[model samples]
Target: MASAHHSRKPSGRASLPRRTTKGPLDAVDDPSLASSRHSPLPQPPQDEASGSTAQQSANPQPSIQHAQQPSVQVGEPIKEERELSFLFDTSIYHPLSQLEVPGPFRKPFLPPPTNETSVARSLEQLDALLSQCEFLRAAHLAGSILTSGTVRPTDSKTVFRLLAVRYSCLELSGNLLLAAQEAKALEDLSSAFYYDDPNVDKAEDDEVLQPHRVPHHIMPFSLRLQALRLQSIGFSDPRRGVSTLYDTAFECREHLSTPSTTPEQRVLWTERLHEVSIWVVNALIEMGDLDCAARTLETIKPGNSEHRALWTSRMILVRIKMGDMAKAHKLMKDSEFTPEDKLALESLLAVADGRYKEASEALSKSEAKADPSMTALVKQNLAVAYLYQGEVPKAKSLLEELINDGHSFQTLTINLATIYDLTSDRSRDLKMSMISQIAGLQKDQGQSRAFVNADFKM
Candidate 1:
């Protein structure tokens, strides 16, 4: 980990867009992320829900809502305020970059926080904006990485930020394109994206690796980017996208695997636990490989208290969804899941038994202990649980608060919105208006990645 302490330069200044070019140091080259002595490889930022939610509520797609907020008559003024802020943010993009992208990317500051709390803190205003097109973004990204110096993060802040940049880029452009197109040209032009310069391998033994340059996760990401870009540009296929992701997953698992067995295995075990426990399960679910992912749970379960409980709980959710209550119960008992996970497990069981009251109570207990996020998740689940119990408003209210969090978990949001629709007795127009706010919340949060990008130099 390296600390990124670039000379306190002004971030997100309004500069005329740099002309994107092909070839070395152009659209593809990124200086901010690279290697040191041609090193190891890489990683998605988070688990956004898909198009379905177990919970339903009235909601509209926020993308549609964003354009209409200013004129809305019924919604909260906060949304209107956010609209103003978003437009201001959007305006900066017009004057800054020749390459178009979402305004947030061009701004030195991150996207505006959806919740009201952050507005009081130092939310630096945006200056530069980017176009939303994929190719220009791709080109800009290549150049940014090259000029940014691909430096190793010496601290947690930089590491998180480095990871964020990697995550953000992949989120926006995780597809491949025709090798001959401008986007492809941008992809091909990036030397930094190459895990390593082949010529480096052939350089005279005396000609050592550069002083502070080596591709870390850069190469793996580059490989995926090329593949993903192709997918983005009408490649007429998903096979490549799926293939690249799994390959990347394999590489990630390999990079994370331990070499030897010893007491150190304990530490390695925990690290691996965090990887699969916190991310792999959810990531797999998002990728629609839940069944394949479930098999990996056995390996992921390790000798740690929190992770062990989280792992067991996650499996219980899978089993519940799979309708395998028997195994879910057995594991629940065997793992002796913590109070929270146990409650999650029990709630699922209660739901099947038509014990709605028991399910709600159990879910409440589980949710009581969750952090704001886990609490929100529990709340979203509560919406479903309530719907199961025929308690629609309880479910609706639970989702409404969750909408405040505006999680991008595609499934969670969709499920919540849909459930609200099913459960609510309100008129169609009223429901749509309310649900649309939640959607906007999700959209706002998605654009504003929480991973603070800290610049790090070796």
Candidate 2:
């Protein structure tokens, strides 16, 4: 929900050699991808019957055959110009049966346009659908446009943007598995084949490569981040996620270290590196490599005191999760965390130590609410502390108030449903009523209004 100021370019200056970090995801170590950077991908073995047809179809440009002429040998420049534009297969637009989506979210109240001709209008409609939290419909429409064979092949920016939207909507609408499956289309995105470097020959002479010489052609950095995560999850390979994130971080670092990088680019790459490091830490944590996660956390140096304090607080929590309570306490004592962060840490420590009343008191402090970002988290913790202190009614009332105020967080809804099950014989009716009330809530044009049945713990 927060805005990122980083440049969305897919690749940093290609001449900057990717630096490898000792982290959980070692993408540079993958033989399959590492070997791809220097050479063209091996063409699949083809039979005589279908190879020519496939090749011709693959390159719709008539001039594609010029490279095969006798005069145009390997390493020789062809006289004719070739269209190297990339296009997605039409198969990606296959009809998505409504039966595939969850029943409750299958049909949107406002249907998406099916035969829109204008790309601009279709893009507008897609944004409107997403704003209304009509994710499934948005996903369908996005997929249609992306794979419609209508967008110009050279317009990589728009193509990847739509891809990101389609994947994002699918995941947000609770079709994570489907989104992951679709992510396989983005294999080896870091391969040099995707990039167009007109000045690539100069690299052989050890010349200073200008950034503008290598324009980005791969998916936007944001989409690449999400896609890599999705691919790793879908393929059941957590290490892949870690490695790819490390690879991206390496690229960011390379950009930061380059003297030719503009001040704007330096700042953007710095932020991107920080974000990538955070993702690497998360991937490490998910992989149950807590020590690696801690090591990775230390590599991130935030630009501001506020960010530093936030990261230190996270490090303290990681230490706690690693069962090093003494280290967690010592880190907290040694660091200069903001008052809000300190209160949050203290409450977390108290909860871990079974001091629910103390935790509640700390979270109830005005300082705990100083940061709007921390407010919901503090309230959630307070509710948990209330429940631990045997004040179920108070906790229930607080959660209900949060819900009534339009904080439709899944945890809040599920916790409220659990309380209903504990206190009432007709909990199902209560949950259904809650769902109905949520459905009736007025959603703003650009706000997410989608809700799934699972949010109520059904």
Give the best candidate by lDDT. Answer: 2
Model 1 C-alpha lDDT per residue in residues 25-93, reported as the tens digit of each score: 011122221221112101222223321122111011111011011111111111111011111112112
| Top candidate when judged by TM-score against the true structure | 2
TM-scores, all models, native as reference: 0.45, 0.73
Error of 1 at 282 (Å): 6.2
Q: What C-alpha lDDT, on a 0 to 100 scale, does residue 443 get in candidate 1?
A: 60
Q: In candidate 2, residue 58 scores what lDDT?
A: 14
Worst 10 residues of 1 by lDDT: 58-67
Candidate 2: give the clashing pairs: 25-242, 25-243
- Off-target runs (Cα >4 Å) in candidate 2 are 1-116, 201-217, 301-306, 366-377, 443-448
- List, in order, the clash count of every candidate structure: 67, 2
> What lDDT, from 0 to 1, does candidate 1 have?
0.39
lDDT of 2 by residue, 1-458 (tens): 01132232223323334546663222223232222212211121111111111122111110101111111111112222312222255443344555543343456433443444667877888878876667767778888776554566556656766777777777665677777777765555566645444455556545634542332334456667777887888789999887778777666555545455555555455555555666677678778999978876766544345455656666776787788888888988888965766776787777777788998898799334657754664576678778888899998898788778767655677778888988889999888877766655534322356556666766
Cα lDDT, model 2, residue 336: 94
